[model samples]
Target chain A: MSAPEELTVDVNGFQTRVWRKGSGPVLGFIAGYGGLPRWVPFLDHLAERRTVIVPSLPGFPGGERGHTVLDSHLDWIVAVRTLMEKSGLVGADLAGSSVGASMAAEMAAVWPADVRRLALIAPLGLYDETDPPADPWAQRADDVPGLMCADPEVWKALKAPPEGANSIEWPIEQVRANEAAARIFWPMGNTQLAKRLPRIAAPTLLLWGEHDRVMPRSYAARIGALLGGRHETRVIGGAGHLAELDRPREAADAILSWTS
Target chain B: MKLMWFHLMPYTELPDDFRQRHPSVWVDIHSELFDPKRAHLMYNDFMDELEYAADCGFDAICVNEHHSNGYGLMPSPNLIASSLARRTTNTALCVMGNSLALYNPPTRVAEEFAMIDVISGGRLIAGFPVGTPMDTCYAYGQNPSMLRQRYLEAHDLVMRAWQEKETFAFNGRFNQQRYVNIWPRPIQQPHPPVWVPGGGSVETWRWCAEMEYVYCYLSYYGYKAGRATMDGFWNEMARLGKDRNPYRAGFLQFVGVGESRQHALDLYSEAAEYFYGRCLHVDPKWATPPGYTSEGSQRAGIESQVKQAADSIVRGKSTGERMAATARDMKGIVDNGYVIIGSPDEVAEQLREVAVTLNVGHLMLLLQFGNMNKEVCRFNTKLFADKVKPLLSGLFSEWEDRWWPKPMEDNLRAEIPAFLPKLAAE
Candidate 1:
């Protein structure tokens, strides 16, 4: 697998960066907090059959400047719509992780026509009063990777410093991304997406990690019931909140098989 | 130079294991810890101390707003200021001040401040603070990103409402009022001398310098911790081509005065320990929500010791290490200048140095802090007012303090009658 080409797409006059790869149908992938890392082998694996489109969420690493104007989750949804429209992703497959998963769910709900199908991995929009999702923002930086993944190796790999010699850039990017995320999901991540979930008409897939520390298994039931239209559920046994990173091959295979 | 007495009115009776047991003293700290009966006595005693400060020839008495906190009991400084306005004669009522953004219609600030000013016979120094993250973002659930914008808009609206003679409309980003007229405008011609209390944000320094308002650094960490911030403020002022008038800045210092240096140390140690150790054991996360500090300020790396302490906590350092880093111990707190405790002459000398070093004309002294009893607070107030105040009063005599309250007259400094001298001679 070859490295993906990084490109910038203008959405509503804001410059957003997207990593483009592969040759077939468009699969728009939204990123979680801290934006997407420079290296993700999973994107290369998925790119063999389908063209994977990974856009940095407005306030994340590569797109920090562009995301400043987006303050609310609604603004984020608008930006995602713009991303789809500008990227020529009409009726394309959509997928996201954690905060990104919440965004994907929102886009599918609000503009069902724009997304042909939706895959949400450990989404964060709906809240269960009895067992709320672990707050990523409140967790210590050292404790973050462990919360994101059950596998210690995966956690260590994810936490490895940015490859660039500029050591400060990585943490700075994290701060920018965290600040951006806080704008939308600070005190709590609930965007009242439960009320709007019934509006989604597209086929949906809800994926959960059994050992997910951030978003527990209890969330699958809540999200599954709230989502509208034909849907399927999958629980990856050994993964954590970020199941894709922990079980990349399984996550990608599930996504590909579902899309096919 | 003007001397003001400030009180946090701390609820000083937290358990010894509060640091171990409670998550924080502010924001998420449990409500059951606050006892109403204790609060009642605290308020009465606190008010009596403020009244005493007024009687003892202080220029002003200061109160500020904090929410969901064991430390700093005043959620509404304006209410306390209102109560103080009637009881004290001639002392400027410095409600430093109502948090503008928290109010639905910020004109409530204008109206209430005006009311206090009128009641105090034109002695109102209006203080506008953007407020702490614990108070504004976490406790109030305000969007950290929009907080500053909202604060700026509210400040503008309040200023216009106070100044504009005609009943006009205010179309603000955060607030909209068709008929923007506040009843009972302040006694001072233009709005009261507006002082902005800040915690070393570069933007705040620029804003204060730009607006020509007094940049009051409410440093709970004391003069040593505040040197960099105050210097930065001066440098910003210089950069903006503003005058280096000492009165344009104010610094908050916690001072304990006694008959001797050792005596002062003995008297204030327990109270200082309670304050530095117990009252400030806040959860690191509660202290800083992202976007609360501006990117510019964050990059500038301007912060207080409290924020640094919170950072250490978040990094998950051992308790002893974190406490050491926070200067929670009596020795560290005193050595770091968090509290200045000494004999009258010693405290006065140190304060003079602080005034000269910070180049501040207004010295707002926290004579009462932590769990210090009412009698001790009263003693500290009297000793400082009688001995320490006279030493520093003439330091900045040349510069005009435009921010000081415009009292109708100096009733407190009234002349002793001619007959009294004749009676004394007879």
Candidate 2:
């Protein structure tokens, strides 16, 4: 089983990058900020059993920047919808990491017609007044591995600093923009997601890193509790915020099992 | 008693519309603020803030590290310390510091501390922390089982780099270098004073005692909460045949002041709520990760929080209720010996009591609480310096001469590598 040809589509006035592979129910992937664009490698191991679809998000690496002030959730949802229509995708499994997980949750909540199953790996968006806030930009790019895994050596191995095309580059600007975005949404991100969790009709699986310093696994329970649909929470041992990067085999297996 | 002020530079206000379109505003609170350009500006402002603290009569201004998180905006405490080294006159630059075990060579810390000490004219307190399980074992991907060992090794390596004068070869299980040499040696003889900050870990106490380092318990929960842990430390110190001399130990407390206790409590209640409720909310999985915290420490922290939550339920306490209900008992935790929050008179009186009770010489005041407005923090800081410091200065001035390290000749020292015998033979 091999990946399909790379496909390009216009989504919300942005040139979006999309790729498909294998021949089963379509599985859409939403990546966290700074994630590699080549989703084929990530899905290559799973392509044997199912088909997968991954799109490069706007303003992210390899994707065109859309509106500067547009809502990220809406932009992503619309982009995924546009990609699905262009690629002739019907019902598919959905998976996302970090910010991507929030988008995946939103997609399942608002457009249940497009998703049959969903998996969120160390997903974000669940903010309680009692939990610590995750600041993606405050960290040195090299320090990310540490933030995402339980084993320092593993994090050290993954410590490829974001650079050139792959790098977000303007960290301070990104941080300020994020802070502004957070204030604008107030509690909507939390309240809306909590409200829409009940609307997610598809089977859902929540994967969390046991050592996730960013969005601690405690948020996993809140995520599971809010999503009124059938949901299971799996905590990946020795993983951090970026569970897939930290413990790929375990994360991939969890996703494959849920989708299958 | 030496007084240190702790500040966590947090981006308090977020732009309005940014929160809406973002997928997860909760997690991304400070990401946008950390953009390269903004980070440069924030760093400058943060440095200025710390410099201001120095000018306000603080003995030392502290900074620490956190990543991909808004709680403590400093990812590189060294950067801030470096800046403070040039900007401040007398205040010591406490890097409270780089997680030694997280660095590959650990000598990077040695070199950096040496550089900062020279830059700051011999005013530097080198802090070597094992780091929290969340920080070390999880964030840095260190083996939790070997975290303590790794930390100790790193500590030794850095210390050797500072104390030894000659370039040498070295090898170790975690760090290996053909030639070991650190430039720009520290001005403080035998290196600046070493301080160890712990979150009530048993291993940390023994290590501090063995090393004869100042053991600073950064009590976030408050004083009463750390009683058992402090008692355990004292017992260990006794076992090591160390005296109950207060100069050998210190504790950190969060203090807030206003015109009256009612005003102080009301003004600080929101910040406290933010700190405990929003800032410290750790998922049970992350908080009690498998093998992250020791069985005993984990059990104790959980039990304490649970008991506090249960007590809150029975008593109908609104303050700290939302956050406390989820975890351990925090009541009197700070009061027991960790924190003192009130008006100047009240906080000073409590400090005197805590110093007497703990029989300690140093008090690290976390003057800045979660998202506390700058104006308020400045006011609180001024009040403490004016009213509180005067009350306690007399108590410890005489002992300073007896216990504190005397001024030493400012000069570069030799460096020592891991394999001293091999280098000597060569």
Candidate 3:
């Protein structure tokens, strides 16, 4: 098992970090809040067959500068589409989790021809007043990891600072990553994303964690019903909102088998 | 030296076990805990206290905004300032002030502030605060990432609205108005002096220095804890080649004056304990939103106290343990410089040193804090005015108070008829 390679590609002067691994069909992955500090078991499993291209969601971690420029959801959609083009992930199978998933869905809907097969894992951007998504933004820094994964300690270990990292810059960058995502999906995750969901023409897979607390299993049907193309739902057992982080192999298989 | 009376107007009747039972005192505090019936009396009492402070010879009376907060109830300080404008003739009405970003179109702030200035005969010290993360981000549902951008843009619009005489088409990223004409313009030329209340953000010091506004530090912890932030402001002033006009700065302190040192402790211990222990019982989540503090200030360790408070919560430091550490007893409270309590002579001497050392012309004192009854608040107000104020008056007499409000002269002021009978048409 080779370690994933890190590369920084400039997009319209904004430096975006993209992680590259494995080989086959290209699969672009975007992780959730505080973005991915590093690749998880999820990306590694997906990379077993596919050439995984995981771009840090703009303004998140490696894409820190995007926070200043991105504004509305339209701004986010354009930024992600351009980032995909610049990272050489254009026309690749797309998969996004949580906030990244929200951005992925937006890209597919706005620029339908750019994405091949789309996989969304408990994505946000839809708000139902009656049974609204549990707020992911208003969380304490320490409790955030626990909310994202079934086994909090597993994700916590992955997010813990690596050796030789500057202590002050480390926590600041971590918080700033959230700040970046927050600019796009702050206050409420909804940006009338429901209105545009019907425009997504790509074959879609709606992957959900059975025990997902953030978006919940109930939201799958609401999300699926609006899709314009062929779509199906899969539930990963013993997983939270981020099924990939909790049950990586199962999640990877879920995306691979469906798209294949 | 100018002394300003500031009231935090906390809900005095939170159940004795509030910090124990409630998860927080702000943002998401149980609404059922609030007693509106009690609030009716509290509001009137608070208003009376401000008016009384005005009569007591404090140079200014201040009120500020906070949303869904326990300790500070003035969600709309402009409303309070309007009432004070009519009631108090001599004192400056410092509505320190509307959260710039929260106002939609932000010209609303300009219009309302102008009205207050007109009604108050031009005695308005405008305040532009970035507001706390809890107030702006959670309670008011503002995006923390965009909050500073929105605040700066809103400020530009407000300043232009106040100064621009011609109807202008104002276009900005956060706000847009086709006709930016504010009626009932301020009597003061250019505008009322601006005061920026800070929580030690490094950027605020630079902004205040550049704008020539008073940088007021509103701290729950007293002067000892504030020296670093004040020094940071002075350093920025020097770098910008601005004069050390002590009037360019303001500092808030929690003070208690009694017949003796022991009597002062006995007089204020409960209120001080309530303020420090209960009013500050915020949920850690609401304290520091991501991007709420700038990277520079966060790196400079200016926002470290807020982070430390959050860290204490994460450690599951029980309320008993936390309270026992700081404001559990009066001795701990006074020692930590959270409150300055002593006889009039002692308090006067202490405050004189605070003004001189901090180089602040405006001394905003929190006389009415926590659930303190009106009687004790008035007692403190009267004692400070009679004994303490005189001692500090000579401290900054040399410096010009460039930031104080400039009211119109008596002969130049507007005069309506003393009484008007009912209209014949009515």
Candidate 4:
């Protein structure tokens, strides 16, 4: 399955950049904050098996500005629904990364019939206020291999500015976004997601990076245990929070295999 | 010229009855002690101690990070630093740091460091450590072998993030972010001074020397074990053709003071034993786990320790016995230079010798060790500052001045642009 070539949708007050490709059962992808259009490589592979829809989230470069209030969960659901309807996707397999993962969980709870299956990679929204989230940007910025992959050389090759900025600015922006998100979802953004998980009817697969400093893999088991539906959780070895970037093939394979 | 007193607030003397009832009870010493109610008390006491240190003429006070361990009670050193920021007046709040590799993105460190630096009114010595294998590899799940690489990258990213004026992209192996921009930048223009702490790693020595960073050798074992490490560093500096600048080098030692050496020993022996036996036991596995320690570090640490121990045995010496005896003899352990426990005068004299011998510009005294009582730790700290510090300050001042001469204004000039950007008419 591959992502769609073009799928425009209104977000906040502007048209957002969304793409869809392939021709099978539709699969929608919602990316994390600051995530761009290029992160849809997995969708390209998934497109080989199914139709994929990917949206450039609001406030992200090349995407529409987010709402003034910027309720990420509500905005994400609206955007995904808008993309699905625009792309003629009645029902689709949904997946998201970071903040996007929270949206997927929300959608599964609120619009259960719309999503057939769920794939969440290092999902946010379950953070407990008492137990603080590990800020991966601060902890592992200097550690290229630690942040990206187990292999130093692999990290070196993939090393480039995140998307819109250069190496230095990327971390700063990431920190700001992380803090903003953390503030928005207090106590544990994902903890509430876990509570509402029983409402989800979709069979869910949770993918985590074993080296995920952002959302430590310690929470994976708890997240899996909470879902009432058939739930599977797998750790991608040698990968950090952005596991797809670190181990793209392995991440894609996990998703593809699961969907198949 | 700045002085900072550091203490790891450990539960030194658990009551005998408590121990009898709780032997091997897995008390979750770190979490339990920090559980809100107790944590508030402990933190308040620690803040008072630090404030006392400041009142006693110290320039700064320090705290550090550890995990799931009783050795150092601080799991989040920043929390301590933050609290100190509000309470402290003239003292610099030093957090040895949040281990870089254990973090994702690594910018969270940049942000927090910046925040703390600003909050402390530029009174921040941002300490970065690659971290010990036991802490880094076991607790944080970082591969020790790749620890250095991760640390280096994290350092580079944070530095760039701090210094860069414009929004930029950071595409690195580990961190990928677009629109790199940070608010509330550090109060210091080019960020704060960076201090790297190590325990006698050759790689650390070379890197510190190369980077011209303040290399702090935490001499937990005392001066004897630290002698070779400091010598190795000076030798490396010599080979690099850099003058032996004392300001670039620092040493940390554990100190306990009393009316006499025997009194000090009596007071600290049990706590020292707990530190060495219970807290310091590296679980061999955590110390040198598979794919944890780097090949270079492995060669220097485990492999070298093994070879040296083997050599001692081959020479028909009492190798095992010597090793075991060294482990048991707390005073010999300190005198041999792992720790330094004595009266104020004795500790002062010892520190002076260490500074002169090692040509160390900075001396970081761990006033608290093992589970030493908080009151005892505070008293020792006051005694050292009041009695000991004044005696040695003048002895090293001339050396410090000679080696670290103030920078000439011309030499310190900034490369400002001649042309300024014009603003559009509002």
Candidate whose TM-score is highest: 3
lDDT score at residue B44, model 2, on the 0-100 scale: 57
Model 4: lDDT equals 0.64
Writing each residue's lDDT as its tens digit, candidate 3 over B9-98 gives: 788988889988998888898889888998999999998888888888899999999989888888999999998888777689998888
Q: What is the lDDT of residue B153 in candidate 2?
A: 80
Error of 2 at B93 (Å): 1.9
lDDT of 3 by residue, A36-151 (tens): 87668888888888999998877787886677777676677777888888778778899999888888898899888988999999998888887888777666657777788888
Off by over 4 Å in 3: B302-326, B415-426
| i-RMSD of all predictions | 3.2, 17.2, 2.3, 15.7
Scored by DockQ, the top model is 3
Q: What is the lDDT of residue B347 in candidate 1?
A: 95
Global lDDT scores for all candidate models: 0.81, 0.64, 0.82, 0.64
* All-Cα superposition RMSD per candidate: 4.8, 19.1, 4.5, 15.9
Lowest lDDT sum, 10 consecutive residues, model 3 chain B, at B312-321
Native contacts present in candidate 4, fraction: 0.00
* Count of clashes, each model: 0, 64, 0, 71
Ranking by TM-score: 3, 1, 4, 2
Better of 3 and 4 by lDDT: 3
Candidate 4 chain B lDDT trough over 10 residues, lowest sum: B313-322
Best by lDDT: 3
